[model samples]
Target: MYQAFYGLREMPFSLTPNTEFMVRLPGHQECLNLLLVALEQGEGFIKISGEVGTGKTLLCRALLNSLDAERFQLAYVPNPCLTPEGLRRAVARELRLVEADSLGEIALLEAINQKLIELAHAGRSCVLLIDEAQALPDDTLEALRLLTNLETERSKLLQVVLFGQPELDDVLGQERFRQLRQRITFSYRLKQLEGEQIERYLNHRLSVAGYNGPALFERAALRLLAQGTRGVPRLINIVAHKALMVGFGKGQRRIPRSFVQRALDDTEGVQGPANAQPRWPWGVAAGLVVALTLWQAPALLNWLQPWLPTVANAEQGGGDESGQ
Candidate 1:
């Protein structure tokens, strides 16, 4: 709604995982690099974990887009909560092996293996990318492990990459999953952007969204934004988007600190400094106290006059030195 006011062609702070708006911060870039390298080496099992809203899905999409179709046969399973048999069918569908859908569980496995062999002979490597894999049933996970066992004389036939939240780590650490965990040759954890990186990320998204004006967000506002969202890209996008809308609503071009605060207050999981009670700075309060004391000093002395010597005694003392 505020795009035109800000001279932006599209929403810069959209939460959608648009590859065009992707900002390759250190962590994300490293994760992508590791994935590409591991896939190139035909690693059996690769895992990537991150907190919610940390861009695991974006990274998954980025990886999918990065791979060359000529060299890789990709199968993506976005939901992994299926039973072992169900998961096999999902994998079969992703691989476009329609015949596997008609077969029994054992027959399905054999069909998938044959398909992988055929792909391998054709100079294409088969890769299964599972997102939200933490929700996968234990039996389903074991099925995945077994899928990796389908191999030729030289190397494994199917390679798998799992993208999931941190709970995935806990699930994999269980004794029942030790075998599958052992097969993970490569792993990378996605992280939220650092303070400095947040600024760059914002600018990158704005530029990608076709914004060329001067910085839309004031520096202080941006700082609060980084603090509020704790550098999580999705949260930053949410808060920033609201701030822009606030600025637009006020017919202002630049997003100010107050606007950012408003945005933070409306967003969930954003604990900005503004949420706390306001307090005066110690230095400022001290200076104010000193100024007040000086201004009221005469009045304070007049108020204490009743406890001082009378005027008659004061005059006698004044004349004592002359002794007239």
Candidate 2:
């Protein structure tokens, strides 16, 4: 609703994992680089885990777009919430094994193996990318490990990359999963964006969405946003979009901290670094947080001195208009 008024071609903060809105956050870029290198080295199992909304899926898609299609036959199974047999057929469908849906569990396994080998022989490698893999059934996960066991004398024929939440780590840490855990040759954990990174993230998204106006979020607004969302991009986007709506509804051009706080208050289940600060403490002190942190101590002291009737510059005729 606010797009045209704000000079944006689209809602920059939409929660969809649009690759076009992707920003080169350091953590994400590093994860992507490691994934490329690991896949190139023929690692059998690679894992990427992070808290909810930390961009695991976005990074997964970025990796997909980065890979050269001719050299790699890519199969994506989003949320593998299926039984072992179902999981096998899901993967087979992605790998283009049309007959897999009708095959028995054992036969499906063989077909998947043959498909991987077929791709390997054609000067191409096969990769299975599963999103939200923490939800994969125990038996299905074991099936995945079995699939990776198919290999030539040189390297494995299939490579698997799992993108999931932090619980995946917990699930894999179980003693029963020792073998599967051990086989994860490479893994990377995604971190939430830091304060400074959030500013760039917002700006990049805005720019990509065709925002040519002045800065959309004011400094204090940005600070509160960083704190309130604790730098999680999805939360940041949700809160930001709401803040813009708050601004637009009020016919305000720029977003302020109060607008962000309103957004935070209206939203629920926000693991809320977002607790609404009370009137006394926040009204009296929160506004100074940015200035205190941003200014050098000496400069801040110097700036304060001019307002104080202290001796450092008292004799320089500084405090009063009439030097009284």
Candidate 3:
């Protein structure tokens, strides 16, 4: 609603994992580089775990966009809350295997394997990118491990990349998943953006959305925003969007600290104690001043009593001279 008012061509803070607005902050860039390197090395299994709203989905999309279609055939399973059979079918659908729905489990596995072998022979690598992999049932996860077994004598026919929340790590840590966990040739844990990165992230997104005006967010406002959102990109975007709206409502072009606070207050799951450090040192200094004043009060009063008469006489002389 406030795009034109702010001189922005589009909404920059939308929650969608739009690769166009993808910011390669330190953590994300490292993860992306790791994925690319792992893929180049023909790693059989790769795992990336991040907290919710840490941009795992964005990273997944970015990875897909980065790979070459001619060299890499992508199978993306965005939702993995399915049974083993359903998971197999989803992979088949993504791979465009024929009659995947009509085949039984055994037949489906054979068909998927055949397709992978064909792709391998054609000098194309097939990568299965599974998002939200934390929701995959244990049996289904095991089934996926088995799927990676489809390989030729030289290299694996299929490579798997799992993108999920931290719960996925908990799931994989179990003894039952030991074999599968061992197969993870590359693993990366995505972290929230650091304090310095938040401003760059905001500006990058704004620029991508065609914003070219002066600084819309004040430095104090940006600092408060970083604290409020804990430097999570998604939360930052949410708070920033609402802050812009709040600024628009007030007909203000520049977003002040108060508007960002209002945005943080209005946002659910983000309305917590301020993440900024407490001013305990100031409190301690104040306490020391009070204690010193109280300790010296008696001596201070005694010292003032001797000077009181002289000060009164001088004041009287000055008054007498004025009277004359």
Candidate 4:
């Protein structure tokens, strides 16, 4: 709603995993590098674990985008809540096996194996990326193991990368999954953005979204964002988006730290304490601003028409009025 007011070309804090908005923070960059190295080395299995909203899916998509189309035949399974039979068919279908739908389990496996071999012969590496893999059934995981059994003397025919929450580690630690666990040639744990890094992350995304004005967030606002959001990208996006709306509603160009505090207070499941005082009053103040704007909008617009572009844009019916 505040895109025009802020001069943003697009929403900067969207939860969607757009590679365009991706920031190469240290943890994510290191994880990307390790995945590249592991794949180049033809590692059969790789695992990446992170907390919820720590950008696991984004990283998975980023890795998918980074691989060369000519050298990589990619099979991405976003949901792994399939049975053993279901998984084999999924892999087969990803390999473009027309027989997958009609074939029985054994034939499906053979078709997948043959397809992997063909890709290898044509000098293409097959990569299967499984997202939300912590939900994978026990039997289906064994199916994945058996699929990895297909290999030439040089390297495994298909490389598998698992992106999942930290629960994935506990699942892998089970004695029943020991054999499969041993096959993971590479693994990395993704950490949340550090408090100091939140500033850079926010600015980086804003710049990407075509924000070229002076720094939009004040230091206090940045500090509040860093503390209240706990450095989780998802949480940061939510709070920052709301804070921007708060600023817009108050007709402020720079985000007030009070606004971020209000955003955090309004957010559920966020862990930060109410470190910033006077929260209720600021919320009331923002409400009063909105209320006052509606009450005296015409006179306010007439008075500020020459000084404020925001009011001028509103007069032109150009200001964003969409809901939060």
Best by TM-score: 4
lDDT of 4 by residue, 207-277 (tens): 99889988888899888788777789999998888788788778787887887888887776577475434
Scored by lDDT, model 4 comes in at: 0.87
lDDT of 2 at 21: 94
Worst 10 residues of 4 by lDDT: 275-284
List per-candidate RMSD values in Å: 14.9, 14.4, 15.7, 9.3
lDDT of the candidates, in the order given: 0.86, 0.85, 0.87, 0.87
Pairs clashing in candidate 2?
Answer: none
Predict model 2's lDDT versus the native.
Answer: 0.85
All candidates' TM-scores?
A: 0.84, 0.83, 0.83, 0.86
What tens digits encode model 2's per-residue C-alpha lDDT throughout 11-72?
99998899999999888999999999998888999999999999999999999999999988
lDDT of 3 by residue, 202-286 (tens): 9999999999988889999998998888888889998888788767666678988877877776665663575233334332133
